[model samples]
Target: MAGIELRKVVKNFGKTQVIEGISQSVPDGTFLVIVGPSGCGKSTVLRLIAGLEEVTSGEIFIGERDVARLEPKDRDVAMVFQNYALYPHMSVRENICYGLKVRGLPKAEQERRLALAADMLGLSEYLDRSPRQLSGGQRQRVAMGRAIVREAAVFLFDEPLSNLDASLRNQMRVELRRLHERLGTTSIYVTHDQVEAMTLAQRIMVMNQGHVEQYGTPDELYLSPATVFTARFIGSPNMNMLRASLERGRLKLPGGTFLPPIPATDAAFTGRAGEILLGVRPEDLLPAGENAPETLRCRVELVEVLGADTLVHCALPNEAEGQEPIIARLEGSSRPGPGDVIHLGIRHGKAHLFDPVTKKRLAV
Candidate 1:
């Protein structure tokens, strides 16, 4: 197992800065996932670690050694790409053992490593099959097996499951977690999918517009996002943000409804009034009665029913023209339908307040 570190890492394409002043550490044997929307430079970060892309400035380190100038082969890290770049003509065994052979390992040693990898990945039953003969998930396992036999110091995965079907992706997620646990290798994973990031990583690094937005455990990013960008990006169905004001320790929403005072702390935005936002997770808000003092009456814009939960899209009265609507997840069954007038209550204490100017969470 190895710990990887990137210090002030920067990458550029011509005049465009793709990765900007990024720094983070991966603890030994820890699985670190870099996640963001497309074009957010998440894949660029993985490629930089894998030595596939040259850094414009800054350093990449493997364990205690600075490898900024090292070649991909010399970095002692294996990368599994989004596409399982398997050679169709090569047998599964050949694909897994190719690197070991090129490295001039003894016949017995290569065979041992190949055998162990195939067995672990349940590929022992298909050793002689070519890439064309295997399923997507099987091909992915071969790609993983190729990396496994390397016994590299670090592993870099670049959306390795993007090509699989939903069910296969889920299956591979479980398999990947088990493999990481068994090998205990330091791994850096990059993906745009938040589900993969939340399920696989010890900590998640959220990126946007070539900058690191927030770095934290999944729960930290979900429960206490560092910025508005993160609060809206990390959650499934997304969190709802409503414009509000703070006046004399009370929340003042649109239409002049005053809510109870939020907890006061240095983290809270004390004096901030206009240009403030109240953020609530979809799972936090609930339907309320008309007499509910803290409730905000919204017209149900849409409803999406999943097996265990239902999402209700709501529009606040006086919402800015052309502004994106808000969404709330109702636990279990939701009796409300489209065009229904519903009262949605802000989850007290659990809700977050942020400064619209700085986009920082108010400590309350």
Candidate 2:
């Protein structure tokens, strides 16, 4: 296994800059994930690391060697692509062993590696089957087997599970985690799916518009996002943003409701007060009693009953025109019908303060 490092790496195509000075490090045997929206240059970062694309500037290191100009084959890495990239005409055994053949390994050694990979991937029974004869999941296993036989120091996966069905994707995610644990290889996975990033990554780098937005563990990004974009992107159902103003240790909402000073000792309230964006997760907003303090009276617009939870969509009276309705995720048993008037309160210390101008999280 080997650690990988990027020193202000940049990639440009003609006049367009796709990667903008990205620098990060992946410790040996760590599973890192690059996640973002489509066209966020996540795949480009992966290709740069795999030596599939030349860096326009800066340097890349694998272990202690500078591999910025190395050829793809010279880099000690294996890539599993989204399309599987299998030769349809060859049987699973031949396809998996093809790399070994090209490397000129002894026939006995090739057979040994093939056996080990096949057994590990549960593909021993499908060795003689052609790519056309196997299911999509089985074919993907064949591609993984091909990479495994190489015994590369790093593994690069370019949305390898995006083509599978939801059930198969979940199953493959579990399998991939297990495989990584057993082999302990340094792996970098790129995807637009935050769920995949959260589940598979030891450290996640959230990218946006060819730039690194935030880099940290899943919990860190989810609980204490560094920016408004990250707070909205990393969580399910998205975080609810309300335009408000802070003055005299109190926050005034759009509809003229004032919340009590939040944690008198919070750094954000020391001397900073102005137009701010308040972020509250869907799960953090709860139904309030009739006489509860600092509550917002809302009219329910819709209610969706999920298996274990219910999502209540509501609109605040005299709210800013054209703003999206606030959604609250509550237990399935708490049912509030459309047109019903309800009051909601922000859970203590669960609210996030952000600078409206910079969109950065305020220190609390």
Candidate 3:
């Protein structure tokens, strides 16, 4: 196994750029995920690493070797694609060893690899069954089995679980994590699903419009997003962004709402007094308890009961007419119906501030 590196890598499709000067590194034996919405160049990055797509400029290295110009077969990396890409007539055992056979490897080595992969993938009993005879998840395992036999220096997965049903996808996520742990191989996985990225990645690189948005551990991205796009994109229910400004040495918000001034220790809000975006996650808005410091009056818009907690979507009192509804994740099953007025206390310390013009986080 080997670490991977991308230095100022760029990809262009004739006139338009798809991956723009992106650079990142994956340490040996680490699992890194490239994640974002569609057309974000995630899949393109995977292809570039797999040597399937040519870089218009820059370099890609697998350990000490620059593989930017190498053929896919020469990269010493195995890729499991979104589509199963299985040969329908081939039995599981045959499919698993096909790559090795094509490479003219000896029969003894091929059988040894095939047995190990089949057992690891729990396909031992189904090894003689054709691809058409297996289930979706089974076929995916076969695809992985094929990659495993190669014993490549690196593994690349391009939304490999995208075709599976929700339950099966969830199951596969666990299985994939276990497989990576046992192999300790440097792996690069690309997916649009944030949930998959959060659950499986050792580190995540969030991309947008050909640009690298942020790259860090899942907790780092979730707790301290580097930009508004990441703040909204990473978390469930999304973080709420509200218009804010400095007024009379206090923080002013839409709907004539006023809160305590930004902390004097927060240098980011100093020497700047214009439009900024205040970001607060749903879970940070708590139901008013005893002696709540800062509270907002809101009318419930909707409620989502999730057994352990209830998601209350509410709109602020008269002052916040046109703003998006605020969501609060409160403990227990106290469901509030539409039109019900509730007071929510703001956990201001947990909130974030971003520069509206740049849409970037303003560190305090």
Candidate that would win on TM-score:
2
Residue 121 in candidate 1 has what lDDT? 96
Q: Name the weakest run of 10 consecutive residues (lDDT summed) in model 2.
A: 264-273
Clashes of each: 5, 0, 1
Taking all chains together, the TM-score of candidate 1 against the true structure is 0.96
Model 3, 1-364: lDDT tens digits are 8999999999999999999999888899999999999999999999999999999999999999999999999999998989988987889888899999999999999999998998999999999999999999999999999999999999999999999999999999999999999999899999999999999999999999999999999999998999999999998889988887765446677766676555742565556677778888999887885455456667898888898989999887434456557889988767878889887766757778888999988875
Task: Flag regions of model 3 displaced more than 4 Å.
Answer: 260-265, 289-293, 317-321
Whole-model Cα lDDT per candidate? 0.87, 0.92, 0.89
Candidate ranking under TM-score, highest first, comes to: 2, 1, 3
For each candidate, what TM-score against the reference? 0.96, 0.97, 0.95
Per-residue C-alpha lDDT of model 1 across residues 1-364, encoded as one tens digit per residue: 6798889999999999999888888889989899999999999988888888899999998999888878899999998988988977899999998988889999999989988999999999999989899999999999999999999999989999999999999999999999999999999899999999999998899999999999999999988898999998998887888887777667787657776666654234455556578888888887888888877777888888886898888877754453346788887667578999888886767788788889988774
If both were scored by lDDT, which would come out higher, candidate 2 or candidate 3? Answer: 2
List runs of model 2 lying over 4 Å from the truth: 318-324
Q: Regarding lDDT, does 1 or 2 come out ahead?
A: 2
